[model samples]
Target chain A: MMVPATSAAPQSGAHDKVPLLELEHLQMLFPARAAAFGGKRGHVHAVDDVSLALAEGETLGLVGESGCGKTTLARCAVRLLAPTAGKVRFRGADITSLGPRAMRPYRKHMQIVFQDPQGSLNPRKRVRQIIGAALELSAGGSGDDRLRMLLDQVGLNPEHANRFPHEFSGGQRQRIGVARALAVDPQLIVLDEPVSALDVSIQAQVVNLLDDLQDEFGLSYIFVAHDLSVVRHVSDRIAVMYLGKVVELSPAEELYRRPVHPYTLGLLGSIPIPDPVVSRSRPRQLPRGELPSPIDPPAGCRFHTRCPGATDICREVEPPLTLYPGGHEAACHHPLNVSSSDIAGAVRSPAASRSSGSVVPVPPGG
Target chain B: MTLRDTGTGHVPVNESAVGVLDVPAEPYAAGAATYRLALRRLRHNHRAIVFGSLFVLVVVLCLLAPVYARYIAHTGPNVQHITEVLDINGKSVDVVSLTGVPVGPTWHSRFFLGADADGRDLAVRLLYGGRTSLAIGVMATAITIVLATVLGLVAGYYGKWTDGVISRVFDIVWAYPALLLAIALGVSLATGGISIGPVQINSGSILIPTLVIGIVYVPYVARPIRGEVLALREREFVESARALGFSNFRIMASEILPNLTSTLIVFVPLQLAHSIILEAALSFLGAGVQPPAASWGTLLASGAPLFNVAPYLTLAPATMLVITCLGINVFGDGLREALDPRATVRTGY
Candidate 1:
């Protein structure tokens, strides 16, 4: 808990400039009732002690398996679900505690596109009403002209604006979702597994549209997905979360080239190679066992149960995220694909350096 | 799979167009197109049309009760003509026989559908009774819907102490069987009537039965609406609305309420049918529509004892009640089928 207060300032140093959005020590815990009578009460630590920053015009990909709190973190960033504890600074203003009315002006600056295209749209409302409602709420320009222009911009026919959402294809509906987010002209848009629900063929189309839209509008994005292959194409920087904690935050190219975290290595290796010979030849690095219950997570490193490289130190004390060259970060006592000298220099926390004697080769920075 | 080249994370603009509708696009026809589509679908349902028309016919005839009484029967619903003689087919007959039995159907302008033991015109009474029954049914339904919708929306949307208080009230009401509750309320209110603020309703007023029947069935309707609202509030669109900075009230009215429209519409006729039956049950037990004024239930009560002597007296009102209830139910089913189009056409890639 005390780690965030001391380490938050240095964490923002990765961005090298004033961030467009910063989430400091964000935590979200859902109170869960006991399954049986007179049982002890507990909280599901969905997101715990996560700090991140997004510079202007940057896309940060959040990659993790299901229930790793990627979606929760994204929602918290947009203020959709207020974090139980944290400071969310958007454009240098603290917005975590702002009421809906107080947050209205800031709403136009950030928007989110949901995962489900069908469920995200009102089925009864016409296409015109669906997008127009957002336009109306923002108090933007003339409704019809702007609506027509939005339809065109998203690559949908303007003439089909009167049709219902159910009448459109899955890809088309997703485009409408993107168009809705863009209607307010937001600077930072959180794409929460936007293309996951789409077909493989249609996924590329929507992803391409999103990519084009970002460059066209000079917008920043937090692209969240479970597939590393999908996130690698659009993300400048990728953050890998494991059991409510970020195990790795690295530059996209550097992460693929040399993944330091065991969880990140497992995720990258899980992506299939098309060539059968190469696919079979490569060692399967998929993590072992199902995800442990979030209500009572593992005591030390949450990934120690699944990590093959787990040692006595990994089982006793959780590793702090150590920064390597070019802003690459990974939290692991025995980091893969890194020199012992690099680990000695990268280890920032004294507690981690003391517990893991392997990195005692070099003197501490302090 | 063509991975867009450029380790710099280039934003791709795929020229593969998603425009151009496969289905022929119609000219913009706005303004409650959903309702229009429902109406079009309803028109194709023969059962709804037939039964719906039957209900309408009953209502129209009930509304013309005075016309039938004055222009045809020449006797009011409560008028007694026991000693009077009527000519039927050129033969003179007493309205009530010498032994105190009422005359049967004269098939003439007077004594139509025969007379009750009191020598009152049963036909005139039947129509007037229908008017009263329909009125109570409609008014009670209106009361139930308005109260239940407001309560359900509030309780479901704001789930805390507000939900606790309102839901407990619903449970208390729900614990009692609807008929028993209505009877209990009806018996108490029918004696002294209701007086609140500047408004007063008489003991024998139809409004008494209406009010009793309305309050009793609120939990039945409200429980469903509240349950639906709970599920609806969690939907992604609702979250999207909140993300857009919509107020709680705005989200409830525009976002949640419109989705609930079909559910509410389907509930209307089913509730109407339920309310009418309950009203009839209450009136039969003598806790409804006092003397002189006639309802189907009261008529049933008055005619049941005279079933052997004048069976038509009982049969006439009973048949009307059955038909009305059946018609509304059948029509409600059709409306549900008509409105249920939530499944959209999935376009194959």
Candidate 2:
């Protein structure tokens, strides 16, 4: 199930080795419940066919609007929610179909940190028991020494391990959550909007702590966030999602410098710049109207309804993720900031070949 | 508009968000376990302590009934003196007047607190009656809580068809008024007795009323517990436990059950009071404790006609019932407040 879209790029040193995690044409559809009598309506297309690869010791930032499938993709990656059709490969093993007992060993290799600090930690349990359960399960050790070490690693006082979750500040409680994920020494940690519930100053501290932990443990992360600026700072590569599809994916700096997809450009434009002069004068490419309901999304490119560059073809034909130069990929016929030479060099990604059967058509040079 | 600079060149922490970030520990709450903290809070509540003591006193006094009857009163609970003269402060008082009016307080050991219409010692009967009432209350509450909690947890956690079945059963039980249901079950169970498999309970046994009252109030306690379990099953901690590869049983036992402790604890005293009152009501209506076995309800029933002659019989039992109920309720309220973690003092950061 590991599609070789990124596999084709051998020169990109990270892709040369087997990817640590791969989501192959993953789709997660939730059956819509009728208003009365538990009847099944049409399914809500939460995560449409999205394929991505994460190399060992890399951070893949997943950014999207509130209703987009970034969080769903993250959950699917960890097998918290098994995908509707596609595959989730961890360390080259197809774990999407593994049963709970069979998935235990694989679970030790992957962990997730949730969004709400307070909600995630059991209020009745002390820090020791909360993190200790994971540690004991994976390593068969419940030593307080190791518990204290994990606490220290997460920038919390080791003595605080005996305390309950509510006694700590929000940031400290979040640290306890991080410590629990780290307890099992997982290689891949899926952070599902971990710092969104925190204050700005505390958010920086937690983000820096995560960065330091990643380097210390050589951990890979799929950092899901709605905050584009935070994702820009942390992700080695970023995937921009719009209504469940990976609209654009590129190297982190390239995504900011030359956003190819119109949706990506709109997301970047929506970020408020620090300087008032630039903020006022800068062109806003922010998408118009609210996100379309995922229950029955529009027929073409899901973003075309809100895309600034929507045309007749965009409304009728679905766009394939065409690979551009520098390993950048975008699923748009009329991509923003792409020159004629760049379009001339583009190739259709392997995962997209089955869906659309054609490369993204080059717009008649305006 | 100005930001304070830190000497270490670190970003300024948000005062409210990171208040407890650097605090070593709470001064007063040093190494306090959650329950220990709750215990300390309970200790500080004057009303709970006072009422709790009162409840303890009532229980202790009732437990000493046999001793009081044998040594102190020199009379058994049902040993009636139909015609006996007693000396009270150099005055001769008949235990039962010729007109069948029972004697008033003799202020003496023989007929202390006076005698009932049957000419039995009122104080002795009251103490013995307390034993029966409290036993029924406690036993019935135990039955109710154990059955309700298990059903609630199973229904709430498994949901779907299991929830559908268990919830409908609870609704069926809830449909009838508590008194009506207890009376119905009591009346039938009273005459026929209860025969479950090899177990046999006699018609006149105290267990009949206990079983009736227990089964009747199940939906009252159960519906709330089911609602709580429903909300608790969806809490993020339960989800987190599932994500940790913990089995469903482990999640329900460790994650869900421990969180339900406070709710269950608060229910115990409240349910005890409710069960006691229900038992009294049943006894009063003659569907509860039968003749020869004394309860506050029976005492009140036996004393109703003698209101003009000897009101002490009815007044004594009524006062004890009110005191017991008030004590349990006040203590229950205090326990709830104490168990609430938010009610305690925090370590300022």
Question: TM-score of chain B, per candidate?
Answer: 0.88, 0.88
* Candidate 1 chain B: worst-modelled 10 consecutive residues by lDDT: B340-349
Per-candidate Cα lDDT values, in order, are 0.82, 0.83
Error of 2 at A106 (Å): 2.3
Q: Tens digit of lDDT per residue, candidate 1, span B1-349?
A: 2434234333233553553224332232222665787787788789899999999999999999999999999889899888888888889888888887788887777778898788888889989999999999999999999889888998999888999999999999999999888888888899999999889998889999999888888888888999999988888888888888889998889888888888899989998999888888888888888867888988888888878887887898889999999999999988987766541121110
lDDT tens digits by residue: candidate 1, A1-366: 001011112322344567889888788888988879888899988888788888887888899999999999999999988899878999789999998899998888899999999789887788888888789755568479999998888888899899887677778889889989988889999999999997665677787778778878888889999979888777788899987887888877788999888889899888878799999998778889999998998866789999887776677776777776557787776778887667556745321212222332222221
Candidate 2: deviation at residue B324, Å? 1.1
* DockQ, prediction 1: 0.40
Please give the lDDT score at residue A19 for candidate 1.
85
Candidate 1 regions off by >4 Å? A1-17, A349-366, B1-13, B19-44, B340-349
Candidate 2: Cα lDDT at A152: 82
Q: lDDT by residue for model 2 over A40-89, one digit each (tens)?
A: 58888899998888888888889998989898998899888889988899
